[model samples]
Target: MTAEFHVFTCLSDNIGVLMRDTTTGACASIDAPEEGPILAALEETGWQLTDILVTHKHLDHVAGVAPLKERFGARVVAPAREAEFVPQADLLVNEGDRVMVGTLASDVIFTPGHTAGHIVFHFDGAKALFAGDTLFALGCGRLLEGTPADMWHSLQKLAALPDDTLVFCGHEYTLSNARFALAADPDNQALKLRAAVVEGQRADGQLTIPSRLQDEKATNPFLRADRPELARSVKLDGRDPVAVFAALREWKNSF
Candidate 1:
């Protein structure tokens, strides 16, 4: 049986995701952004909450972990590097570790940029990535606790994933990310088309999470930092891609 997913909004713009293995009826929440929405989704899908997989120590992502665990006796799986922050974690994982939600297994990849210990869960069999704040639809996470180089390297790991992979990020920042993308790569036809689509989607009160990695590779400015066009866009045509990435990140900070 295939893995199933349910995406919903929680706590303003935060995106809450629930994954389940159909064969064994095992369910896991990507991050417990809020308790009510998670409980509502569980009730809607009738999937038992068995696990809480945490990507980072951000409060918005983990605020509901304790409460939900208290309610369901769910196991909390979190990053080992930030174990102190997630005191409820039952399993602490690092890079290359595999976490199993019933029969579905996800490879743990440490993507430390948004936070020093941030990680993304990649379910290779399902071709899905649960990228907390490491990456977004048209943008990436702000370098709050890591350097631009750290973020750039972290993005590279994500960019190398299979094109067909589906990316479920942590927030609903696609429209704004699209606007910034268009400004950074004004001549990108693909980005222009995507921006228009995002605008229409938002205008119709739609959610734009779970974007395809293929589309993101083709249009996301942050992922295209190594390209010459992005280099020139930042007026650093001959600089290294890391430098280009740094410039783009700085511009995006205030965009």
Candidate 2:
């Protein structure tokens, strides 16, 4: 009984992932930015959604929860720490908690940086993670509710995953992020080449996301902020990992 997974992009720049058990037909929707796209995706796949796995409380992530719940009677599972934001969680989960959609089991990794209660769902066997606004393909989310240290730890956690892990982030900010990455890490030949590739993709109206963790490790500036080249470019005197992280984030806020 192999687990099946499908990713449907929603909103202007958001993703909604569908995970299912091929045998039991149980399915889970990872975040609902909008109803129309989610409904259409489910219909197209002929999936019966049994769960709504929310990553955070941001409207862009959970705005369609009510409608989806009303339509499919799906149980809402969210981080217990974010109960105030996700008040109606039917199942309150915490770090290391596991949720299932039939044979597809996802281990919850609490990553509170983009949001204080944010958590990314990692299906280790599947090599997939539903990282909503914490880590992007070539970038990381802005520090909205959490501090730089919080985001740093969260990113570190995600970075420790298998290099082949497919990172499904929240938005299509890759191309723009690559441009910034070049500015911050000019000596990175791989990042420069990636920027060119991403530019071509963007020019052709393509979406650059769901990037492999390995690619991100090489090209994502947020992840490479510790590199000597990036550290020097950011002009942080200390060269500490935390200091480098802070410089990269500050530069991104304006980028």
Candidate 3:
């Protein structure tokens, strides 16, 4: 029962991840940011595309859905709310839905706010999470289609996942994310130390992503909505968790 997940960068900074069952050669694409890199990855691994799991309706995330679906004749599975924006779907699922690929079964987590229909695919047994734009490495997606309250609740859902979950998000925004992270939580020793390490990675032109959920809980301001230090920095009038989250997100956007 050997199962492995392969992750690759596609387009400019988007991610295309494939979870595979080694014995069955079955695979599923987390997002369709681009066709070339994903096609190449599939070719190299000799895995059959079983399903296309779309998190949201962002162009960078679903632009290649049409071509990829045409080529592989794979079924499109997306959040029920964004089914209209995504390419034709064979299944429209919401939170708590389960998607299977060979021996792997993933729980569909609805984590909106980045987009009205954003969702995450969590393989509980594998300790992996394909969290599109909802949750990033050391940051989170901007509040585009949802409000601060919406995003705050959405982030809390991801935070509740197991600490060891290996988060695979949509874009490669860790470096810039770390910059804002530093400004928002300068006293956080973990973030301060990681900022330097992230700088070194960027200096070498390397990608800094797939951060552990545990690390994000410690550093990501969005996920730390309850931290008293962050609450002070944001200066929320009340002890409202949502207010703290909103303030932190606003500060990060300007940062």
Winning candidate number (TM-score): 1
lDDT of 1 by residue, 93-165 (tens): 9999999999899999999889999999999888899999999999999998999899999999999999999
lDDT of 3 by residue, 1-255 (tens): 556777789988898888887767777898899889999998888888878888999889888889989999988889899988984788899989998877878899887788888888988887888999999988889999999888888888889999998999998889999998888788999999888988998899777767899999998888887888878888764588888988888888888
lDDT of 2 by residue, 28-68 (tens): 88888998998988899998989899998899988888898
Clashing residue pairs in candidate 3 (N, C-alpha, C atoms within 3 angstroms): none
Whole-model lDDT per candidate: 0.95, 0.86, 0.86
Candidate 3's C-alpha runs over 4 A off are: none
How far out, in Å, is residue 82 in model 1? 0.4
TM-score of 3: 0.95
Q: How many residue pairs clash in each candidate?
A: 0, 0, 0
The per-residue C-alpha lDDT of model 3 at residue 74 equals 86
Pairwise TM-score winner, candidates 1 and 2: 1
* Least well predicted 10-residue stretch by lDDT in candidate 3: 229-238
Which ten-residue region of model 1 has the weakest summed lDDT?
Answer: 1-10
